[model samples]
Target chain A: MACFLVPTTEAIVTTIATKIIEKKEKEAVSTELEQGVELSSLHRERFSVKLNRLNHLLWGGSLLLAFEHFWHGEIQPFFPFLTAAGNPADWAEALHEMSTVGVGMAVLVTCVWGVHTWVLDRIAQREGMAQHEEQARRAIRK
Target chain B: MTLLITILAAVVTSCIWYSSARARRLKTGVLCSMFWGASLMWLVDAVAEYIELGAAYFTPAAQDMLNDAFLGFSVIVLALTVWVVLLFVKDPDGVVRSALHNQRS
Candidate 1:
């Protein structure tokens, strides 16, 4: 329910994706009569490159964050599984907390992702149809 | 700390996944995976800490909790910073590049 914390990232990513999809769809329809599959491949490749770049950034930043946390003494070398607790009750409580929070967050993220996919697909479909109509009109005028 | 961190990570991860799924671009997937990975890491940490602290884990001192919150916030900020940098580097829509070229012309 508290998903509005990062509106900037959402807005930037959305705008960029919309622009790329529109451009690629227009190009595919106008230039290639029967190479629809190739256009799909190209679209996939665009995403791959973007994802790869993000992955590099993610890894680099994560390592730095980890080191910082280590310095702060929040993270121990033994970490999640191997750290020693004082008793069974404390261990159980921690496990309970982790499962409840971790799993809850996972579910929430999945739901948001699902909604985003649905909405974007609808928008893309509508835009594609509009483009098709414009192309048909040009052909008739010629 | 673990709880807060996981929730925030999940939120960012979902946003990234949605962007990737809809645009069919890998643009945000890296961010998504990173957050999810971090969440997993914290999950392990929580489990380990619980095992160590047993019942006392439920009643952590105020200072420790505060520290965890700060660390969690820092992680989220760092992730966002990285994402922003990648956006500039890739300039997926070439908006940055075009703006520069236009200014030069």
Candidate 2:
């Protein structure tokens, strides 16, 4: 299956940025910003470890399913020869077809994962910065 | 071919897991996990098929445990991903209001 997170993540970030962070950055919602997160106070290292483990397990898990599909006579059996583009009439033909598109699909998946991770990193940084600023402002107010 | 497939699956899974775990801790939700997990799954199977081109390389020791593990992981993670995403989309303001909002209340 296609990785759904690239678009989903982008959509989420875009919405949050446009409606929430952007307004704060522009000083358009100063009141809400003051009431929202005191960003820097977050302890994120613990969270990071949890996310990393989850990613590895899930990615591996996905591959395992695909393996099962072929091993158990799902896609691989039908394709037969492993060729690309058109469907094969037998297992031999399906095997041949697998060479071209399979690799490409793998690369596509890795790339999507990379991009999604990149966005997550950015989100973490943004949250950290916001928290820091909030803490500083509170300190000054005191 | 099976040996290579096993190796491919192990390496890719480890990398994805490590990277994604880091992302999850820092970011807000489970989007990265689902995307990364699904992508990695496809990659492992795709590579195995590609390498199986040489019948001589196929081995006898494929791990059946992998299937069970993956199935369990996918179901749990996807469910969590869906729940988290819906929560974020439906009430964008709630998360930022308080850390307690994030708790399983």
Candidate 3:
């Protein structure tokens, strides 16, 4: 009840304040920039999309596992909305124990994935440098 | 469950088969065939679990056979990937030289 009341009060105040604060849109924005310049001509951040995907997948999987198996009972009564598997009271200890295992596993997997990425990046970079050198050699030969 | 499993297995096999078949002219077709054939055998085992058999001759045979087949093919694929990565690393300079020459020509 306190959580609900506090947030509601805050929201109402914030909404009224927002209405009092006048907001205006700019009519015209003029900016000039040179065209025909390659974006990659600047130093680009080389990011591995695979690693980002893997991080998202790991986070989402852990969140689902924690919610379904760990926080099943307690967080439900306050909201009175979430469906739980059963009384987590009996299994709360078990859930607490499993958290150690889950976090340990997540850390271990993250390390392994990091190692694999490091290997891949190092190999890719070495190969790329080798290619650049080869091209330079050919240019000199020409 | 049986039907769904069979369909999923079929899709996987089809993909492996397609990739294997589309390998360059120099590449052998044995790998693709072996992989898909073994997967089919496993699918048959899964199907057998749902099936009611009066005769006991081939009842337990499917799983045992498929298990051995999966083990064999997986080892072969593992060795193949190792060999390919090794090959790529081995003649790195020569490959790069040829690549640059081809690009220039």
Candidate 4:
């Protein structure tokens, strides 16, 4: 649950926030330049492309993890809580195991994905600032 | 049953990933994440069952197997519905906006 929810929440928040921030920045830059400079579509396009790539990486990584677990026989075929066992004791045991191991794995995966997104966001921010500085310098020179 | 669930989730996730990759968009990222999450959830469930059942895990009652299949299908449908809602809200391409404007005009 965490694996899915964490990334989905992060993506939605970041994507919307980034869009808002970009719009504000564009407006500010435009006012400052007084139409002397036009915002380059390239930077926006690059950001979009980079974000898409990151999404792909996250998806692919998760898929690979699932496959690896499956290969290791760590994943078998059984539904615990949903199925009633012949022995009530067995059902209780299954529930206990799931709550512990299942929850732990979900938390672990969510944290890893959160860290990945943070690192990627930082890189994108740094690159974006650098590009803006270069553009400013070029404008001054011109 | 858990294995089948995992496989089904994987297949859907892959399809979404492939389409998103071709379009070079992250619009379906949420959907992929949801399915992957569900897959992982089921994977852990499977492991626990195997641990409990040991060798007997391979042989499940026919009725129980059917119930599991129903549960798996329910999960897939739920995930798909959630994804569709997210996509509608996001409206990345502004199609919704365009349609609204056209209607008003």
lDDT of 4 at B23: 34
**Best-matching candidate per TM-score:** 4
Q: Write down the TM-score for model 3.
A: 0.34
Q: Write the per-residue lDDT of candidate 2 for residues A52-86, one digit (tens) a residue.
A: 43444344344444444444545344533222324
lDDT for B15 in candidate 1 is 66
Backbone Cα, N, C clashes tallied per candidate = 13, 41, 0, 0
**Docking class for candidate 4:** incorrect
- Deviation in Å, model 3, residue A117 alpha carbon: 1.4
Tens-place lDDT per residue, model 1, A5-68, is: 1222333464576567767766765666564455543443343343334333334334533544
Error (Å) of candidate 2 at residue A83 is: 14
Q: Candidate 3 on A6-117: residue-level lDDT in tens? A: 2223334444443443221111111112334444333222343434423432432232222322222433544434233254563564454335443344444345446767
Q: Candidate 4 lDDT, tens digit per residue, A1-142?
A: 1122333344455557557766766676667578565555434443444444444433433444334344344444564312324457755754565467545545544565557667877887789899889999999999
lDDT of 4 by residue, B1-105 (tens): 745775677676778678666432545666665556555555665676688899898899999888767666666666567666766787777778899999999
Higher-TM-score candidate among 1 and 3? 1
TM-score of candidate 3's A chain against the true A chain = 0.46
Best by DockQ: 2
Q: On a 0 to 1 DockQ scale, where is model 1?
A: 0.10
How high is the lDDT of residue B5 in model 4? Answer: 75
lDDT of 3 by residue, B1-105 (tens): 222333344355446556663442322223232233223333333344446464552455676556545544444444346435544555434775688789999
* Model 4 deviation from the true structure expressed as Cα RMSD, one decimal place: 9.9
Ranking by DockQ: 2, 1, 4, 3
Q: What DockQ class does candidate 1 belong to?
A: incorrect
Q: CA lDDT of each candidate?
A: 0.56, 0.47, 0.40, 0.57
Residue pairs with colliding backbones in model 4 are: none
